[model samples]
Target: MNPGRPATGGSTTTAVLGALAGAVLLVMVLVVAFPDWFAPYPPERTDLRAVLEGPSAAHPLGTDQLGRDVLSRLVDGARLSVLIAAAATAVGVLGGALIGLLSAAAGTRVDSLLMRAVDVLLAFPELLLALLVVAVLGSGAVNTALAIGIAAIPNYARLVRGQALVVLRSDYVEAARMLGVAPARYLVRHVLPNVSGPVVVLASIGTGTALITASGLSLFGLGPRPPQADWGAMVADGKDFLQLAWWVSVTPGAAIVLVVVVMTLVGRGLQMRVLR
Candidate 1:
């Protein structure tokens, strides 16, 4: 019944979401910065005495079929997952943004041709495209990251092109052109900056998707090989023992969910702040 209560409620929700996102980020950082400290046992080490054990003081999240520590593997997996996501997102954003700029600057014929190409890429399902690339390139962390980056480029290209076109028509760009600014200078100094805001937000959101995709590829035996401890790979390895040791699968799965959820929340907040 309070007249001003809606604003209060919205602020509270944002604050809570922000806290959740911060905690997730901190956990990821810890996993990367102090992996050995967080993981009591080596991720690849097998402990025959504790094979397939449930959660216990000696192994907080239990042991896997190979008797490797579940918690250790999950912690190590975070580092690999985040690394691949960041690398793929960077490649997509940089390559796509540049292509989008070129297409926009070159006018109707170029724009149409580039957009059509984007459409072709977009026509295929993202996962399918990634799988195709992995199949061709062969599976490994680097190849998986490259494939995800390539799969994501068309989306960023389209987004940046649309934004660049809008900016191209703006008064600043026209004034720069009239003042005889070089095309490269105009784009770098004026057009690119304005369009980059949305590109950045999109890139942040894309990170979570990239991580999920890379992990999925790895799970399917098309990503990093054994002992690397990627989250998807962990889940894939534990599937056969699901009934015997749920912790092996559940721990890594939960970690993936938690990280992706927090990233999504952060991306939404950034979009609201920047794109609004």
Candidate 2:
């Protein structure tokens, strides 16, 4: 057995999940990087005669109520979804990590105060919190990103703080403190690196959550305005035509589900690897 490989029993399962996730990730990346090249028709172009058509040679995935190519929209939707998720996760990870580091380093009234504030924020359900933020900030891609990012911060902050506290007790951390290392240097050089693995895993998982949240917001008419080709907006537009053009809503919904499921599996795999 290869020393680096997992045991045979669970390895097959992991491999299958990993393969599925890798395929989804590849499709998502390709769509975002070259949407026009992959799309069969312009996402915004409409053909009234083609509206509600089922899958065919001309339109593999069929056409929506607006006669826009379903496949093209789906592909472009991947780009939007992935971009929003990545941006929100990046914001959450950086903001949360900084807040966590500060909370741990302060170690007194400041720590208590910050954690209490986080607790207050965490008291609301994530979706509710996101809704509140979006309502306050008004809807758009930027606001959606910010709302999702803020909603995710408490989770990352708590995880980072726990990890940082444990790292602070380690021998190396003690040595650094005894050597009179500046608090900033100690956190940057020691605490942050040691606590980063779990944070990374959490951020990956949070990306899936962010994507789902953004989609939900869009579907509810609180995201980017129409004609922008967002997956949620696509689903919303297809709702009225469900009897005739189910593919519009169904396809985008499936895309969202597939992306989130794959991301979750990948995140779990990373966590398992980290634990090992």
Candidate 3:
């Protein structure tokens, strides 16, 4: 290959993954935004006569134990997955940013106190922290979101704090300080905007993490109640029937894996682009 020519293999792989991720995310968004448009039957509608039936023309993904259309339930489940992920990501990002900014802006005593608390929280694995919170709040979609969001906060808080410290030490910050700029105005206008890029990247990655945590919680019976179509719950529902009907559990599990992998790839791509 000519020295001037860009390597084809690595870039080609990244491009392919990006395209795949984008296509998956687009489908997910379409399903979540308009589930009724994609679903052939009401997700809750049951046909007991057809229970555990294999895939056929009428039901492309087959039927669950209750004879509910697996395809329709999967489409409906997309709504819950996307909603919880979005909500939890927003909560984690916004709350973490505020805490991080506060830690950086405050005096040494306050900064020390806040960072120590964050460190303590970070000591635990994200799932364990989420499970602890869910145990206290009780199981439900809202609680699941809150639990995952709270678990996610420490990561963002530490990330933002590090960025904030760097921005605070920059020459423009020094210049602003010299010019007698008010502390509040200086931090808000100069500090935050500069540090926000990294925070955005972190939030993008954290969204996938939040989704996984939420789904795991649901699988463990800590999310929305039964009969509601949830991907995690669907997988749980089919666990015992895996030997007889694999599609019921496998389809939803595959969806979760696809979503998480795509999100991570996209987030990594965005991070690389941002860094460049």
Best candidate per TM-score, number? 1
Overall lDDT per candidate, in order of appearance = 0.88, 0.88, 0.89
Instruction: Tell me which of candidates 1 and 2 scores higher on lDDT.
Output: 2
Write one digit per residue (lDDT tens) for candidate 3, span 163-248: 98999999999999999998889888998898888877787778888888888888898887876778889999999999999999
Q: Tens-digit lDDT track for model 1 on 153-198? A: 9999999999999999999899999999999999999999998888
Residue 199 lDDT, candidate 2, scale 0-100: 90
The 10-residue segment of model 1 with minimum total lDDT is 2-11
In terms of lDDT, the poorest run of 10 residues in model 3 is: 199-208
Clash pairs (backbone) in predicted model 2: none
Instruction: Return the clash pairs for model 1, or none.
Output: none
How many residue pairs in model 3 have overlapping backbones? 0
Clashes per candidate (backbone, < 3 Å): 0, 0, 0
> Residue by residue across 121-234, what tens digits does model 2's lDDT show?
999987788899999999988888898899989998998999999999999999998999998999999999989999988887888889889999998898877678888898
